[model samples]
Target: MVRATMMSKQQIAELVEIARRDHTLWAALKDRELDQFNQDGSVKIPSISILVEDFVKERCGASHNYAIGSLIVALRLPIRQELGLPA
Candidate 1:
């Protein structure tokens, strides 16, 4: 049998906050990339996955699994919004 460690509500909230901040930064980076791409038909911005991994490593010093899991959970709202789903 495998045991799972669950984060407390406060921990989850903190993760969400981190995610939101990273998301905002990611959006700005993407917008910049879009503008650059429009201007020259090329993009040089790093991938969002790489950005999130770096952010989580720098901010939380947590494992890759934790970082990815938090990002997936955090991105749910934004993904839904992008898909035109109800919040």
Candidate 2:
């Protein structure tokens, strides 16, 4: 199951902005090969590694919490656009 982290909305926004501009960052976030799920079949978000944490922090001065929320927000963009939903 994915761990939960507390983050400010502004931090999430900043991380999203950074991911949008950096393809490497974008790829890291978009990739979900390591995802786990709960007994209810809901996705269980995995924790971020130190390396990924550092990379994101380096770009947006955000912490793991920010990355957690930003990842959700970031991942949704492509899906939303693909489905013709507002992004």
Candidate 3:
């Protein structure tokens, strides 16, 4: 069973906007986390490092947009691999 994590609609909408604003800005923000489920059979969310707490707070639903943006800014970011499937 592949259970999904809970995601926020508002955050997703914002992420979409961010992607539109800059062509490749958020190209790496796919919503799909690892397929591994928790011990309870629920899917796990992507964990952000403590280094990016402020960025995480600014984002919603694990805010891949914010994380990606921060990564871009730090020049140490990674791209999305979920095939554009945001929460």
Candidate 4:
């Protein structure tokens, strides 16, 4: 079993900042395809899986599952922020 390396807060923050500068990546975070709407019209955000998959395909060029895992770690902060979670 391969263990994933944890990203430091600073590292996560930096990655988030970098992602913010990328229009495509930032837009993916806000895309409706990745969201679920409730009966009350409140939104339930999907996990970052789709975004990570897209990121890996466009940037990492790695087809392994680990690429998605690594992306989730790197983009954790930004993903949470997009979901309106407290950072």
Candidate 5:
């Protein structure tokens, strides 16, 4: 079991960027995607991605990770703010 390590906010930010650009890769991230052996062994996978997508897409009825990832990165990137996302 490959253990997962704690990632810094920058790392999360980087991942947000990566997942935002690559839809396929972003979609691939799942609760079990990370290594099972966490270094701290106290890590808990966040459902933030799914929630972010829903918030961005405004599809609260159905969750979309890709759209969510894009929104997160878009907000962080400051380039695609014009996209049809609620302020």
Candidate 6:
């Protein structure tokens, strides 16, 4: 099996661009059900994150890997910037 490696900033940027253009994928990412909530009302995506990671990897022809924290940071920073929020 081909093990995955960390996705570079460029790769993550490309994935973000693709997600923006694809309505279905964008929706999936936005779906509340895909997120796991903790008892304190925070996300606990031990499994959910993996699912999203795998989904993105597959979409990008399995080129690179997105660790849980890296994926969250990569995706959130852009949205935060777009919303005029501090990143």
In terms of lDDT, the best-performing candidate is 6
lDDT of 3 by residue, 1-87 (tens): 444343355554454455445443332222223233567987544432332343344554453333343333232223232343333
**Candidate 1 clash pair list:** none
| Candidate 3 deviant stretches above 4 angstroms | 1-5, 26-87
lDDT of 1 by residue, 1-87 (tens): 344345455765676566566667657534543343445766645554566557666766755335255554565556456556666
Clash statistics: count for each candidate: 0, 1, 1, 0, 2, 0
Q: Could you tell me how far off, in angstroms, the CA of residue 76 lies in candidate 5 after the best superposition? A: 15
The CA lDDT at 53 in model 2 is 67
Comparing 2 with 3 on TM-score, the higher-scoring candidate is 2
- Could you give candidate 4's per-residue lDDT for residues 1-87 as a string of tens digits? 666445456654555677778887677665643455656888654436676566545553554433345546556655566778665
**Candidate 4 residue spans exceeding 4 A from truth:** 32-47, 53-87
Order of quality (lDDT) = 6, 4, 1, 2, 5, 3
Ten residues in sequence with the least summed lDDT for candidate 3 = 72-81
- lDDT (Cα, 0-100) at 50 in candidate 6: 61
Per-residue C-alpha lDDT of model 6 across residues 1-87, encoded as one tens digit per residue: 755567777867777787667776455554433345767997755443565577676775566544545665676665556556677
Sequence-dependent TM-score of model 6: 0.51
Cα lDDT, model 4, residue 16: 62
Q: Give the number of the best model, judged by TM-score.
A: 6
lDDT of 6: 0.61
Clash pairs for candidate 5: 3-37, 53-68
lDDT of 5: 0.43
Query: Which portions of model 2 miss their true places by more than 4 Å?
Result: 1-5, 28-70, 78-87
Clash pairs (backbone) in predicted model 3? 28-80
Candidate 4 global CA lDDT score: 0.59
| Local accuracy by lDDT, each model | 0.56, 0.55, 0.38, 0.59, 0.43, 0.61
